[model samples]
Target: MSNLDIFVGETSGTAMLILLGGGVVAGVVLKRSKAFGAGWVAISLGWGFAVMVGAYLSAPKSAASLNPAVTLGLAIQGGIKWSDVPLYIGSEILGAMIGAFLVWVAYLGQFSAFLTDPQVLAQQPAEEGLVDQKSAPNAGPVLGVFSTGPEVRNYWQNLLTEIIATFVLVIAILTQGLNQNGDGLGPIGILITSFVVVAIGLSLGGPTGYAINPARDLGPRIVHALLPLRNKGGSDWSYAWVPVLGPLAGAALAGGFYQLAFA
Candidate 1:
């Protein structure tokens, strides 16, 4: 594929991934939504279907690398050129941001209601004039609709969980999902990979919300920080690096492992 095709496909696919994936979270977390409190199973299934749909839509154009970690893994596996890595990662992040913005737009009323609700605001920490990270280090209520956070706030444990979960995800893709020429996933590969995502979510998502994709976490988190929703507390910037770095580290390890054991 040409450079333009790769950019367009990655951007569009990643957008679709976040749109549906984030949309599901919004539906579950936000009040007034029909799927509110639908629980974790719905989220896992929604994200899996989102991945499948995004991959299927973009497969023919640019191999459907919607995740930056996946693109990095492919690059390390020599399935993609180093020079083109920036294009793929950039597009993925941009697409993720766009998708998150769309999620906000789609749920504007719900967000307004949730954030402006007296009960929800009562649960938030008081401003106390100026607040530091320590004062409100945890994510705000609405943040979960856009990004991941830990049920337990141990950084080391969270980081390790993300790393291990992402390692499983990336290694699975490297080993089983790549097509004959090792460029991208085939149709069956895409479906199986989506199931792998669902499996990871069901088995390991509780700790750190299973943010195995840097773009999926970081881009939306950025959007969460920037949006104008009332009573939306901190974006948990202190913990942001864990998701971004952990997934990249896992993908790197997975790629290295693939080179050593499978290549």
Candidate 2:
């Protein structure tokens, strides 16, 4: 496909992917949503289906590399050209940001409640002056809806977790199938790739939320930091580099390993 086609496909696919993936998190976490507390199973399945939908939609164009890690891995593995990596990653990030904004619009009422919720307000020390719940120390409870966090706070461990998970993911993608046109995954390959995401989530998601994709986490996190949401917590910028760097490292390792072991 042409460069323009690649950009459009990745953008649209990633936007939809984040929209559905982040939507599920919002539904489960936000107070007023019907899916509130629906739990981890719902999240994993939702994200899997999100991948399925996004990959299917973009399969005809840029092969639906909705994650920057995937793009990096593909480039390293020679499945994608290095020259095109920037385009794909840029499109994916933009799409994720747009998707996150759409989620805010879709859950506008819930987000309003997130800011003004009695539970959050009750915690404010009356002497502190009207607590800017919107910009509260941790930004309240909306951070998870936008990005990944660790159950454990070990930076090295968290980085390793992401690297391992993304290694598995990138390896799976590299070995999945050869795209005849050399642009993206085949249709069946896309379906398999979605399942691989689900498997990774089910097995390894507990530690650090399995941020196997850089764009998926960073893009939404950036939106989280910028959006006008009420009581949205800190975007956890301190830990953000783990997800981004770990995945890139993992992709590089996977690509190198593939070239050595299988190529």
Candidate 3:
């Protein structure tokens, strides 16, 4: 599935959830950059598009969920606060979910309008499959002929992956956020983050689908349940806890590590 592929079939507009969920911080960081301002930060579309384009390169055939795992880790490490955590995450969830839904409806309309066009229908199966893989990022498509995806199967393994992946993501963020770029740290910080996400998605996205965030997985999972996906039964409650629990564990570990480094 190309970057645009999984954009289809959003029963609850989950695509917005995907974009804003991840872009919220990315945008703020950009605004704080020397070249940008709070106005630039408010340019939600710009940041979203920039990050999406960067991530899209790695995921021409995927949804690029990016996972809230990254956010949870940074928050715990003191890069963000507990009080503000809810809104950012809530925005992330709502934005991505909404975007997904809109993309789905848009594609559905296109498909219905161009029913005979094989290419239009060609992307359908992939996006449909993406809705299923929302809990885990970097997990391969569930639509391929040899697609053997684990449906919330292993708790510890999934949890472990979230921890490890978040570690990689958080460490990179710490380095970038603290580093002083030419003019300021903001631009490099974002570029650093986008790069970390891309690198993680490419290198370690194979196992447990790289959920990395409780909210990213669960919020979208909720959207999946609320939405009316075809033949989309079994919301996979068994593995829901993995993303939530694993990311928090990873974030706590990051906090410990950051404190150790600073102290």
Predicted structure 3: lDDT:
0.46
In candidate 2, which residue pairs get closer than 3 Å at backbone N, Cα or C atoms, i.e. clash? 133-231, 134-231, 138-233, 138-234, 139-232, 139-233, 139-234
For candidate 3, write residues 40-145 as lDDT tens digits: 2233334334354534432332222234554455565555445545544554565455544443343443323333444433443332113244543433221110
Best of the candidates, lDDT = 1
Which portions of model 3 miss their true places by more than 4 Å?
Answer: 1-71, 109-152, 178-185
In angstroms, the error of model 3 at 263 is 5.4
Identify the superior model by TM-score, candidate 1 or candidate 2: 1
Q: What lDDT would each prediction earn against the true structure?
A: 0.86, 0.83, 0.46
Candidate 2 per-residue lDDT, tens place, 51-152, comes to 999988887878688999999888887878889999999999999999998999999998898668877556632111122333235544677777887766
**Each model's TM-score, in the order given?**
0.93, 0.92, 0.58
lDDT of 1 by residue, 182-231 (tens): 67999998999999999999999977788899999999999999998877
* Candidate 2, residue 138: how far the Cα is off, in Å: 3.2
- Which structure among the candidates has the greatest TM-score? 1
lDDT minimum window of 10 residues, candidate 2: 125-134
Residue 212 error, candidate 2, Å = 1.0
